[model samples]
Target: MDSAAAVSFDANGTIGAYQIGVLISCVLLGVTTTQTYIYYSRFPEDPAILKALVAFVWVCEVAHAICVAHALYQFTILDYGHAERLFSRLPISLDTAVFFNALIEQSVLGFFSFRIYTLSMKLYVPILIVFLSSVRFLASMVTFIITLRLPSLQSYNAHWSWLSIAQWSTSVVNDVVTTAALVILLYNRRTGVRRKTIALVDKIIVWTIETGMLTSATAIFMIIFYLTMKERMIWLGAFTVSSRMYSNSLLASLNSREALRSMNATQVSLHSFVSRPGIEILQTTTTNTVVDITAKFPSQPQPFQANRQCEEC
Candidate 1:
């Protein structure tokens, strides 16, 4: 085969991977919208700043989706039957989408970093997270600029590959560090708390780990693919999905607050019921008179006579 035919044959896998990535990112856009709606409906009383942040993130996600879709359409439809074009031409939409992804990721990271500061009542960890996130975003911006200037897809690996690697590396590091800080802060809060409260904290910690693992793992895979298959576009495909993970994780965390609050309230109610002052019991099932009276007159507003007043009456 001639050189042009060889390039075209190799480009097939890259295009296929890119197509799959675009589809997944689009699906995640739907999830982002749902989570945004849930947050607005459930947490109307949340601070204006928080509401604004959600709106901003949603808008960025929408923009990113548009760019990704446009890029795919340009390649598969606008330039159909011309695999040589894929090698010779670069899609502006693809590069622009990278910027939007960087923006979304940076914004989410900032929010989480602030949360870390609030929870830990400390500065160092949040600052570190912020720094790493900023570095990653800057690296992404630089990569986008450099890619746009490159002559062809083949040239990407030859020049400014380090920026691509740096961008993904910092993303992984930021996610892991932020997740560890939140988990540690939450675990510490579990101390000196009731069992139910501890359970609630554990749930939050688990979520933190899961989200952290997802984003970090995605970035790690992107790096691995980029390094191992430097000529292929598999890593770019992973990049598309990794961006969506940030917004989804943030929205998921926000929407869960109400459920966590309900769990806490339920636990408190159960604890109160089980520990009512005048409901003492013995081993033989010989119920106290106060318990009998309260059971009989459950609607009574006044406390019944007992060694201690019937707090439940």
Candidate 2:
């Protein structure tokens, strides 16, 4: 191999190492977050759905860890010729794992949005969002498989340009749609002059939207980095590792005890105020009673009469 090829190969190794570290971190964060959410949060009011989503994320993270580990092992433990043969034959493995990881992330986000929607009583929209997300996830997987199976796969320069464009375009479209839906939910909650239930739902929707936006932003950055720095191993590694870390960290924060406590406190307060009947009436009556009692004091005329009698005596 020439100097450029040697450099490219070395860069791929660095990217693989960086990916391993990122995957490990993601697994840890996912585990921690899942535990915290399950133990500290309100259990999603539908434990089964929550459990399923958490399980999905955990499984995906495990797959990602496995793939990364395999890549690392291949690069470190095997000779170049052997590693090349193995990867060339099983290139789909790592790619498929990553596609699944992305699917898991998207599924978790969709479920979270659904949870917010359910709580707010906006039931119909979540179905559409989930469907759209699922379609996008499937598209990503298909593209990944196609890329893996393409002939001349060993030529890094084989210009899988169409696949790359499709992957990014689909991803961007998905994010835009998801983000827009979240924004609409938030706006409806804020502007709908209906009962306080809408307001409560709004708060939940806002939280859900913020979390989604964070994840989406990280994904966008990762896609951009991957496209622009495909040939630069250091840049690719840095972007991939940092983006993965941000995503995992955000997930961890969402499932943290602090997040649960805050959410619980807000829910409790809202429920208490909404469930209590005659509270406003009672407060009004108490104020009125105090005023009436104060106003019932004897007039100064009695005091004047008593003083006049004392002076005469």
Candidate 3:
């Protein structure tokens, strides 16, 4: 086959892979959302802010899945020429969907970070971080839109690269700040001095750190993949698919309902043990009157001494 034909064939395969990856991601997100709901249900007394944050994240995940699914359908069910023609015909709508999906993903992550901060009670810091991160996201979205509007890939400007870099950089910073907030919370807790509390905190911290690290790592990989696979659409698609799958898996594991349930159970047990009623002594008595006193004498050794002196003389 000619080079152009080979490229097209490879692109088709990539598109298929991307579709499958997106479907898997969608499934994972759905499961995660359900699990989150269960956790929220179990803790009806939890802070409203946290509940609202999780709800927002769930909605964002749903929107992301829908947009990705539509994008996949546009690319796969329709022929490339036809798909391109349609996209070109309604460029704004298609681009808007893509932009919104990306925006939602980042917004969800930021929201998660903010929730972490809220749990830690580091009020002003999270607010500042979210604001800064939102700016970065918006800037990246604008650049992405411009990139999409380009006549062709060859004519794509380099500014998009800068924007992607900014987005990822800001993401890393946000995660770092969130992790620090979690650390501060753990440290401030008197429970951390105890063995069980220490172990629990360790697990929580590990999961939080892992989530942040994985996100940053995946973002880096996507950036690299996008840059190198400019000519190979299949590789690009594979990268996108793998990135989303990895993210979904990490999120599902981190937000597992079972883990949250277990933590709650532990807390309840501790509280019950500490709060249970115990016996208390109410009165004390002292008796000081004494009647009998006896006086004893001393023994003399004068007789034995006289005998010893006579013997010595």
Question: Residue-wise lDDT of candidate 2 within 213-296, one digit each (tens)?
Answer: 655665566566556654433322332332243235334534432343322111111100111110000011121210010011
Predictions in order: lDDT: 0.72, 0.44, 0.47
State the local distance difference test value for candidate 3: 0.47
Of candidates 3 and 2, the better by TM-score: 3
Clashing pairs in 1: none
Better of 1 and 2 by TM-score: 1
Tens digits of lDDT, candidate 3, 92-175: 333454455455556555655544443443468768667766776687578557756676433442435566556656666765
Error of 2 at 206 (Å): 6.2
Candidate 2 residue pairs that clash: none
- Candidate 3 vs. true structure, TM-score: 0.64
Q: What TM-score goes with each of the models?
A: 0.82, 0.59, 0.64
Measured on C-alpha atoms, candidate 2 has an lDDT of 0.44
